[model samples]
Target: MPATPGAFLGGVVVSCAVVGAFEAGARPGGSAWPARARRTELCRARQRAGSGSAEPCNPFIEENELTDVGLGGLMKPLKRLLSALTGPIPVTRSRAIGVSERLSAVTTLTASLEYLNQRKQTQPGGLNHWPTARGVHGRSTPVTRKLLDIISEEKTTLTLHAARAVVSAGMLLPGSSRWRGAGNIFLGATTAALHPRHRYGTDGSDQVSILVQTATGLARFSARPQTQDALMWYVALQANASYFVSGWVKLMGKAWKDATALGGVMRTKTYGHQPIYELTQKYPRVAKYLTHGVLALECFFPVVYLAGGRLARPMIASAATFHLANGLVMGLGRFVTAFTSMHPMVAYTSAPRTHPSVAGRDDRVLQVGAVLLAGAASVAGVVAVQRRMRALEGWPHSRWLTTRHGNQLQYEMSEGDDESLPVLVFVTGLVSTSEHFGWITEKVARDSGYGVVTYARAGYAGSRRRSASSYHLAESVDDLVDLVRGVVPEGRTVVLVGHSLGGELARRAAVALGERLHSIIYLDSSHPGELNRSHQQSEATERIADGMNTLVRSLNVGLGILMAQPDWLEELPANCRTRVFAQYTDARFWAAGRREWAAVEEEFRAFDGKLPVVDSHALVISAQQTIDRDPEQLLMHNEIAEAHRGQGHSVEKVVLEGADHDSLLTGARFATEVGRRIIEFLDQAESHATSRVCVVEEVGQ
Candidate 1:
């Protein structure tokens, strides 16, 4: 076998009739190309039927609305779907499916071989353990969990992988055309079914494999040549773009630019080779040249299309060699096969238009260019929508205030006719926006008629930090204080509600506010000493803090498009959900978060003394799941409550059942419960203060 067997095999396919078919528009297995006139007529009919129009989808009632109607409501749509699926498969589709199956067989074989080598990790309690490694998806519905469990068993997983391997092997053999489609179908299903079970120990290679398999599988069933061509082009473009983006991202990093990145990676235990690290150290100049060479190759990968595809062969060879070296040095063997599997498609797409076989073919390269342009335009449209969502004017009555220190903060203030009640001011956690407290803020303002104020901290949302100097924990507290003083009415006492790191800042602000503060509510707040007190917290801090800078760099290089939308964002009220999502996707938001994280990590690491407490009413609300995950955090909350009690103040501690730190604010059910508990605490505090005032008047008389 060749050192890069996948690429070599792919090259073989493109060198034969496959290339003639792929470039000249013919059916697989040497079938003659159909008449272009007929293809044009079919496309015109599709357009007339409104199937190819650019119009928006017709609005229809949601699925829930049909549930109570009867079986007819559901059966109507089901019948339409069945009719569509049973339609004739076009010759173009059949040809595409044949080509897709041949490529997918190789991908499936390489993937199964990689999984088989790591079979031990798929068992219970291993690194890639199922059910336990589901992460946040563990909270999925009972039916979903039951379905997941079916394929999560050790024997079932191993059997499916073996079956997929056998199918792929059979499909790759000579005279196996009769079983190719069915085998590809089976391999596709098995690959998807086993994905979630082995999230651990998987890398970019696994992601690339999944992407290629999925795109090809979809193209295999598409009825239109245009659709198949677009999907194939997407695969080829993605393969090239991945290399380009990765190179630029590395360029953004100081270590990569200075040629120290290779040495640093080799020194790590996870993806490292000690011998390579020692070699880099011994011959630094040679290492520098090698690193720069890699940067040039990756950054210029897309140049393969230049000079009528003259650069394609050598570029593909260099990339294969790079993956081969990575496999040998870093144990990333799957990367070699997974990435190489796309080279044939890349070669086919980038081949010169004037090639004899492609001379009379349709202008596929021009059509593909139009598709690329449309995609870029769509991205721009989404960004425009995001800007509209982020505009402060979109939020009614939202106002901006500039503090004395020159930092600008955006805040929303709501108050009913009532004037006697103390204003409720909310402070969100690090990297969080005021939208996090939307539920609680609305509930308090509407039900209790308490004036409510929620503001974004400096450099968050619409807020602006005054300078680009180093950030500190105290700077945020100062901003919070400035925001409070600027927004609140004169002579009105304030009730502070702080969540996460906001809780610690609120404590300091409460001391600063003196008599102007009435009560404090802490919502799953951070403790000053958590890094030292909890081993889990200490480990998590190191890992998260180390990655913050890299995350910012990734987002800055336009990789934010790949960031998955958070489930919490969906749970927020419909009015503010888009706004929050806009900020979440914005690279600037993450850059601000990274700056604050640096200060926060530093402060947590150097935490040495107890936090100061005030002689005021306080409520410490802990999430049950937070305590369950880290028991020591509960102890810290208790200490906070005790500290306020020691200062001769009224303090109550309550745990919100089934709520985690984020869910306390994001989950509607949990946030409603949290809101109710907070209202109850506020009422009790009001009554207590009233009783004290009565006693003081009586004593004066």
Candidate 2:
């Protein structure tokens, strides 16, 4: 549909009205809300909570925090005077562009100023120094690397900001129309730099500002009416996508559905408002209704185009109030202009094509098809790249075995130079891959001359369950038994090592392996009685369940790009890092995790605290945090060790310092230490066994 000039200008004016209201709400202290009173209340609340500090509760402020204030009182009268002076100004394409450009310019100017206020962070040894800043770029080409090096220099960055400030100032001038396009282009580049440099502090305002500036710059250069319409359509579509996608994603989260998301957010010191938090706590029902109201507005935001733009004003007004409220309560004041600036384009596009004043052919069919095609292409490209990255090399080569239950389990195995030594059969935890054991497995296989094997359980990684029915812990245990029996030679001794849920599987499998089992090592493993015994575990189970549910749904719908590469990537072998990350971002991995968790939660909830007592040497390696944070978990691990000791077996308990549950395996340092301890324990156990055999032989002679 063509963007009729009148419709475009009318939309821009309507957008200005919202901006006018936003300006009117500005106060002397730069917020419509009573900031002093809020702070006083926060201080009182903290004091009541037993904080005896003399000073008010002031945390470190971010760069965005410095510039999030509303328009000051000084500009209010001036804006009103200007409105009176230009009461009857005719709506035109140039005027609309001017208004949008100026709004975007103001946003960029304030952001650059805010960033400069925190300029120390851009210097060497600061949070945003080149070394730290460059990590977000991942693997870049040499040319791009050189460009990053140049732009990341403290002097260069500061100069760029200075230049951006000047460009923004020029954009604000009424007679800078000739240079508006170039100024916007420069501003877009500068705005784009802020995210990769200071990703932690920047918000939607920074992102929206970039989009506005770039689109406006491109629109300025395009003289064709059709091109202008297309640009406006692009902005409107993006605005709709931003809201709907956000709402839909949040809908997948259990917290949002249960209405606790807002309360949880407001309880944080970073973005919290004590009053609003208290209100949520005191009136949960009201909070629920309010949360759902937000979801309704966001999820159905595209309805603005319905009824030939009749609903546009009400929806835009609602959104304005929502942004304003967020500004007041969440201290995101700049969002008002950053987001609402796009409202003009939305309003313009919402106009009826059949209207007498408007000129357009309804080509929405082609637009929709084009959008779908682009989305599919993007998803396909992501899939192909991920597949390439996940390709593994040499040892731990992918292999599969079919189980009795018709499930196909994927495993990687390597027989180290020695065949006599008991194979170290590694079992991984739920939702985790065997690749996570890269560091420890390498250490054990190299130092101890023992064959190492790692396998993904059914429905995890390359493993697949034959049936879509409910998963059970017994089924996974059975699958492990099948994998071990299929891979290991008959009568070969096996040292079973398990982490978390894998430990439970190993324990059960030991009962089946009988005399073939040599030793058992549990690395911060799960206890059967955890859910029944510990209140904390039960609460965590609920949260984990909810999180898994959200993850499964989100990834299934191809939102895996939103997932970040975990910091633990460095813990694995260099060749395995990308493969592990690829697996993590794959939908099938999370789906398997969800299924496994459901079975685990169910089993744990019904657990009677019974576990098999294995008559073998046992080593219990517990992470320090596991013991420090949850004392019950320590007792449980000790209980596991004691059960083996009861069966006339030697047992050793060791705690690794500076390790957490996942980090015990995923942290290279901790994993190495774990491997060292395991080798030591194995040497002692074998030596003890050898001495006992010699004594028996001497007696027989």
Candidate 3:
């Protein structure tokens, strides 16, 4: 509605009159409030709380504190005017502008002094919190979550009664009742919430302890007023630290030194068109120095406060004033948010989830910052802690094997429903780790009474990478042979199990070991016929050469970078070997890993050498499901298994029906079935060995 002429004129006249009165009274000392009043009040507040009296249990202040301290950001501005005239403001400027702190502070002090003074006269030394007739109780911007809710839902008219809330700024002034009680209560609650670990844990933090300690001291001291001043000064220091830092960081930047550049940056996304930005533009040099100076003060103030003695109170009082000025000049939400963020002890009451600005900011920025902070700190902290615990429990580095390439290798061991026993040692496929086979490994251990061991090859998992020339089936066999010799050498033969590429490695290792091997289990290992059949070795060699070329590119410029752009390149892990790191870490290394297997398969099929004879019990556990739409791929698994089984070895075929290949080793289905078979095999093997030993003993007899 348009303003009525008479009414509008009346408002202008009143505004002029009010401003004149405020300006006059605010001239540093219309009455020049005695600093002693502040000190006396502090002492009285303690006395009022009878000696050993329990802390206040009022609910009004507790809930109101949240809004007052600043979390309810959107309501701050509307509340500011109310604070000025009614004295609801925090002590000092925050309270100085509001009638609240001054009113409370005075009432608390007067009541306490009267009680304590009377107690001294009557019985002396102690009159804990003076039983007072009780009572007590206690932002930011409009663009908050609260504002959005209001706008979207068409809530009440905000402009109507906003002015009615104003309180006297002077009420928070020294010698006022509000400042004594309200500020003290605020000081008490906030101190309780602060982190004890923070350096200045005592500054404003130990309010309860300070109060308790000060009570007896007050009675003894001739000047209790000075002590109160000191305490206020300390609390204020912690509250205003951010103003110094924000101004400092920005001012130190090169652009801030140059007026034009500083203005440009201010106009950039950093500050937008806020009043502070405008102020910055008008006084670049002054702003820069002031910002830099304040930051330096904030950075070091905590240290000074912690140093004890005369440094604490004075420094804190200065900081509080700086913050108050910042609050008055800038809007509430920013001040409230900033204050809470820096020193968490100062909780501000804010309108619930509302924006500080009119329309709110870009949601994308909020989401991104949230992710960045949470991921870098909270999420990472949890993950690192979990890993540490697992490591502490003796889960070794061998759990996740690294591939020749930088990437990790995980393979699920094969499990099939065969009640025979076997001591299964699982070898994972290329670029796979035993972690994937947790199900199958557990099954072998539990149901089969079988012991399973899986590990990464040399090049994978940050292990040293070997050259292409160094990675043939023989090299793979050698590694397995070494493991067997070292870890389980006494076991004449362990049921060796391999899946896919792992199977090929297992077979080669078995053949290399000769009579030392017991039985071999191949889980749909790669077949020679799946790849180029005609030109075998020569063609296979060429494929290796091409892979080496890709590996060269990866090694030269970090593999992930070879495939993508430079800036986007991930920092190669320091522990990774160059050769394997280049290829496997590329993420495209998978294709190369598969290609390497195919080449090996080609070489195996075209071999003219005679096959090794195995007299041990063999099990061919096949995955019954198809993962990809490949014609020859599905047939190779069966064809290879049939060929091995037909070689006159005591072979058992068990296809885990309707299961994915990855889960074959780790899933419950594989574990329950595969474990039972392996256990039986081990029992039979042990029985046979015992029988042979007995026969030898009989011969000796």
Ranked candidates, highest lDDT first: 2, 1, 3
Q: Model 3, which residues run further than 4 Å from truth?
A: 1-394, 397-423, 466-469, 532-615, 627-648, 680-701
Each candidate structure's count of clashing pairs: 0, 0, 117
Q: Scored by CA lDDT, what does every candidate get?
A: 0.70, 0.73, 0.41
Winning model by TM-score: 2
- Residue lDDT tens for model 2, 1-701: 11123333333454466456433322323211223445556656877897876765652222124343465345656754543332111123444456667777766666676667777777677777778878877777888777777877778888888898788878877653446788888898877864676756678887888888888888788767666666667776888888898888788777888899999989988878899999999999999999998998899999887655556656776887887677667776557667877776665566555432234523464477598979886986687456534532213567888997899887778877777778889998988888889889989988887788888777666677895656788888888788878998776789999999989888878888878889889999988888888788887886787777777776666667767777778767897887787778776677778888888888888878767667777888888887788899988988888778643466788878789998888888889888988888777777664423110000000
Error of 3 at 118 (Å): 92
**TM-score rank order:** 2, 1, 3
Instruction: Give the worst 10-residue stretch by lDDT in candidate 2.
Output: 692-701
Q: Which candidate number maximizes lDDT?
A: 2
Tens digit of per-residue lDDT, candidate 3, span 1-701? 11223333332343234323333433231111222234445546756876474655333343355464655566755554433322111122222222222222222222222222333322222221111101110023444434333422211211211111122122223353333344344333322322121112122213322242222122123234334333333333334444444444444344433434434534655224466678876777777776555555656654432311123334433454554454344221122112222221121111111212111212243355457766666654454344323322222334333333333332223323442333367787865544445555655555544455665555443333344563456666676776665554363356777877788778777656666677777665654454443343334554454455445443333323324322211221222223322333443334445445655755765765344444455566666563243445445554444444423244455556664455555455554555555555455545654323110000000
- Candidate 1 is scored at a TM of 0.68
Query: For model 2, how many clashes?
Result: 0
lDDT-best of 1 and 2: 2
